[model samples]
Target: MGGATTEPADEKPAVYYANCAEAKRAGAAPLHRGEPGYRKALDRDGDGVACET
Candidate 1:
């Protein structure tokens, strides 16, 4: 049987930016609703858009 695969130590964790500007500065802007690192906090209005500056 095959065992579960482990994540690489060098792999970085998902980053949740405080605002769209922050996410854009990190080159992770234009985030959609389901994209990684996208959080509801980023979408203050909760209109299915995140990190939209």
Candidate 2:
């Protein structure tokens, strides 16, 4: 029998954005530090928010 796999709530998914523009276009801007698709590169000021204008 195969077991089901689950991801941690605090873990980010495979989603990724090369830049803020992409995130904004995708309507996923202003990503929190622990949110899915949120990356350190996106957080320019090292703040919790990402893609902030």
Candidate 2 yields a Cα-based lDDT of 0.87
Which pairs clash (backbone N, Cα, C closer than 3 Å) in model 1? Answer: none
CA lDDT of every candidate: 0.82, 0.87
Q: Each model's TM-score?
A: 0.60, 0.70
**Residue 11 Cα positional deviation in candidate 1, in Å, after optimal superposition:** 7.6
Q: Write the per-residue lDDT of candidate 1 for residues 9-52, one digit (tens) a residue.
A: 99988767877888899888878788887888888788877867
Off by over 4 Å in 1: 1-12
The 10-residue segment of model 1 with minimum total lDDT is 44-53
| Each prediction's RMSD to truth | 5.1, 4.2
Q: CA lDDT of 25 in candidate 1?
A: 92
Model 2 Cα lDDT, one tens digit per residue, 1-53:
67988899898658888899999999998899888889888888987898988
Candidate 2 ranges with C-alpha deviation above 4 Å: 1-13
